[model samples]
Target: MSAEIILKANHISKNFGLTHALKDISIQIERGEIIGLIGENGSGKSTFSSIISGVYPATSGTLELKGQPYKPSDTMDAQRCGISMVAQEMGTLPGIGVADNIFLGREEKFTKYGIVNRKEMYQEAAKAMEVVGVAGINPADPISRYSLEERKLIEVVRALYSEPEIFIVDETTTALSQKGRDIIYKILRRLQEQDKSVLFISHDLEELMTVCSKLIILRDGVFIEELEQKDFEEERIKELMVGRKLTGDYYRSDYDGNFGEEVVLKAENVHIKQVLEGVSLELHKGEILGIGGLTDCGMHELGRVLFGIEKPVYGEAVLGNGEVIHSPKQAIKNKIGYVSKNRDQEALILSASIMDNMVLPSLSKISSAGLIFKGAEKKFTARQVDGLSIKCREITQDVKDLSGGNKQKVVFGKWLANESEIFILDCPTRGIDIGVKAFMYQLMYQLKKENKSIIMISEELPELIGMSDRIMILRKGRVQKIFERSPKLSESVIIKEMV
Candidate 1:
């Protein structure tokens, strides 16, 4: 027998001022089905999911849930109507305990008369965490104490607690490690067994192929095609998403590991209060130095220290000119840029416009006689936006309105406009689509050719192997091994050092 339709969206369209995010799109979800939504940046993937999850109201559309007219006023309304979502951006609030974040809108359940039952809430939160296979997280502790991956898991637990019939996951797995991904996969399988439905959105084609029984493709705010599991093809999907055949190598073709002798940035015996222990490395001129390890490893911290965002308790990061980096001002003055892993929190200001963010780092350069030129600022911002192919109706559009991948592009554009000599990019392509990833890799290669240095910190081993002149593996706050790039370099060899 055919499966029952749980949700149906007909003639759905969304508009943001002059920008039309979704254009006459229609789709349906089936019970016990896990559908993968694939698209490039700004392809209406998130906008569609947001409409269903009650983040936004469609300018024109009709939604029916179990053959009943469904119109949710807000996220809570959607949840109450048997729909829940784990968004792409960080969803948990800071300065609150994990239990509070898990049961944010439903605290009345633990409220007795006029008082909230903290103990009961904590117990239930603990059980929820356990259900998602997340351990060592105290429900009473502040959510800020946890890492990005841990916070994402907490959001997952929150979504699951709603017991929704239809769940939407929007580009969430890109921030997760293999272990965290396994936990998510297990949850999806369990949901399938229970005859629930899921809308899985991700840029990782291989991952989508593995978890989804069918795929839906979108391009330029239009529905392009849909493919069944039997017809899945990576190249075909890429072509459909971008509306063109992807040409050239995704990463650098040559395996030559040679770099200039001059050390652009050097760290000596750096220590980060239990996160890194006597760790040291050198980033050479025109070299792509890749740092790889588990999510809890100290690579991300090391990047911060190198960029002078965090001061090491023991040692220091020095420049080629023998200048000891002490603060972000000093680092930026010496032409260093940092792209943080937590993009939403540390990298880009969501409330600010794209032009405001792109010109922030280059203000001094564009200023004359202690006065800023609006024309120059606009020109500078325009160059980066056009060069990066950032999808936006206008540069005045807020960064938060753009898709996740486009938001990341704004972060990169600011640094590129500043003309930094050394870049410390931590997970630069975290939530970006494949088309943007290719452009970024090419841009890095171009930068290397221009004699600029880059230190790329990523969790994906394939990316490290593909682009780095050298790969450094860290394990439990220490440098385990540093391998020079070569044709024979493999993830298996690197995994041995990471664990």
Candidate 2:
């Protein structure tokens, strides 16, 4: 990384109406450097990056790019100023082709006399897709035709097409599979080779440590600490980010793999066309069944098939009582909970209030004569808010206002409030900080102790080995191997089957 300063934030602060999103924060970015930003939800990490990328005008701050005063009117202006951001949330436009989505703002190249040239657009889009290592996707197909992971990869390509001087990657890996992640990492390294800079924001500490040359910690909208490449350590960075020392094993250290013989949930020959092929599994009472795989291995689709969110052309997902679940309502009625990998799009209602979202799954319990009681609902919501320690202004606070980690907490709170007996958590700790991730692991452990079953599908191998009673490795939509958890189980052993 070069010693030259590329971007500088001077006393930056942001506010949304009455809420202070960012405090007086100052930081510097060096050319040819990958900077990692770490903090808990609502901690101003995203707020700072957003301000720098011109997503919103900062409440107060001064910015300098390449040793000059830089103030972008908007995201487009920022892009023109050689700064680009890949947002935490999905930003692709629906109903458009992949090519159109990648080149959304740069359409002038394909326009002639105010008319768009479709053939050229498709060709350019395909080239970008290939450059990003995305295969088997038709550029002419609608963006909606692809999965969430594919869409995220497309966005990465979009950001790179312009070759911006500085790139902001905001919690994007949560939406990606391993293949997509590898491609992104390669792209970042290549950017560094070109002496460009990257501001990488993620909850995955290991990833940050591996890729970042510098680390910045933020808390409750305040700057905490900045560490050099030599100072990158998982536990230390985690402690600094949370503003307290973590006191226990991050994952359950116990090796008691014994679980109930009676199965709580079972998937039999489940199939989702090309996505999942005859995938099957059994979740016993009190067992954490960890599912591991690479992208295109069907682990994600398997979660949907088992939860009744995606209808399977073959086989069944059965409850203990021989009742087959065919719909989300049926799964919920049977005490089954599903937290999708794409938390923002598939799991939570971003624009709704905390109270409304918390009470959504169990509306029947809080309603009388199809009329809801606000007092009773607020009480129920408050319990979850306290239980999960969700940082929010009020129960009436919009979920969109909360940070990424807190938004995930709201999703967990919803399921916990419903008293779900069987939980299907896909990338449950994807975008959360270490403190919140540890809490989530504790919750899973407590649930296991209570004899509730869990199916944890994650790209994170450590989480799988740390918490699962048994691990199932998948490849190309088929079960490759299932290993009983032991002290000897390691990521290397499980990864052999995954690839």
Candidate 3:
């Protein structure tokens, strides 16, 4: 690893409207270093990286690359200056081939007489895929043909193809499985070995500790502290990020497996063609039944099937009152709720207001015989916004403008407002900070106490082990094993069945 400084930010700051997204921040990335950026959502990690990589110009201050003033007008400009960023959100364009998505914005390289050469693009894409250790994706297939995780891998390949001197991974790992994560970790290590710099942003502290040589902490868009690898401690990092000591058990303490005798929801040999095969499970009242699996292990699909978003070809999802879940409207009418793994796409209306999203699902309850009461809707939305402690300028603030954690809280708020009895949550805590995650755990326990059945589908093993009464491990679209949660239950025991 070289000690040569590759990128430097001198007192950079950013503002959107009247909101200061980043304060007077200054930082550096040396060659061959993997620096971890940690903070709660909207704490300026992405803003700082964006300014450095030229997604947009900073409001104030300057940046230097290898001792030269670096002011890129756009992402392509940054790319020309040897900087590439894998965004936290899905960056792949739909309807285009995988190769096309990988080489997007650089199609001129493949141009021959004003036409792209398909053969050469495929060859280059395959090489990039091989270098990134990504396989099972055909470059000829449309980008939309792949899952989010697969799309994220394609984005990884795209960023790696440039082989930039400064590579910024902005919260991309949360979308990946263990295999995908390992591939990225390997790439980060290889970058370090080649004396290139990597700016890694992740909500997973354990992953940061494993891969980062140094860690930088940010709070409310201000630089807080920097720690060497030896100073890495999960609790201390959480404290600094939150700016307060979190004093409590992180997960639920009670491990009693005693749940309601009645099954609130049951999947009787539910099948989703190629995705899910003969998956059967029972969710009892007042229980958090966790589903743990690999990314493609059909756990996400199970949530869809149960919530009537996707119809099962073979079997049925029966509710407590013997009502079958045939469509999402039917599921909603029957008091069943679902929080999708894809929060932006499936759960919340990003362009809509917080009040709009919170009141959307409860319109049926808040409406009169022939008209909707606007004041009642506001009251209802405000109650949930306050209850969830969602950080926003106002209830009318756009959901898209809020942080990832606050957006997730809005998802929960909408469901909680609807007062759903059975909840199917897929990756509920994905890409959230430790403080929000702890609050979510406590909320789940509160729901469990209220006798609301929850079916949690997650790729995270620790969360499943920590909060579940019983965990179902899925492998290849089938239930491989089921473990009853106890004081003795550990991640190793659940992981044994997951793999």
Best by lDDT: 1
Candidate 1: C-alpha RMSD to true structure equals 1.6
Instruction: Flag the better candidate by lDDT, 2 or 3.
Output: 3
Per residue, candidate 3 scores C-alpha lDDT tens digits across 266-310 of 999988878888999999989899998878889988889899988
lDDT of 1 by residue, 211-324 (tens): 998899999889999899999999999999999999999999998887899998999999988799999899999999999999879999899999888988989999998899
Per-candidate TM-score against the hidden true structure: 0.96, 0.95, 0.96
What is candidate 3's local distance difference test score?
0.90
Clashes of each: 0, 0, 0
Model 2 scores a C-alpha lDDT of: 0.89
**Model 2 lDDT tens row, 400-458:** 87877788889988988999999999989988877788889999999999999999998
Q: How close is candidate 2 to the true structure, as a TM-score?
A: 0.95
- A best-first ranking of the candidates according to their TM-score comes to 1, 3, 2
**How much lDDT does each candidate structure score?**
0.92, 0.89, 0.90
What value does the lDDT take at residue 32 in candidate 1? 95
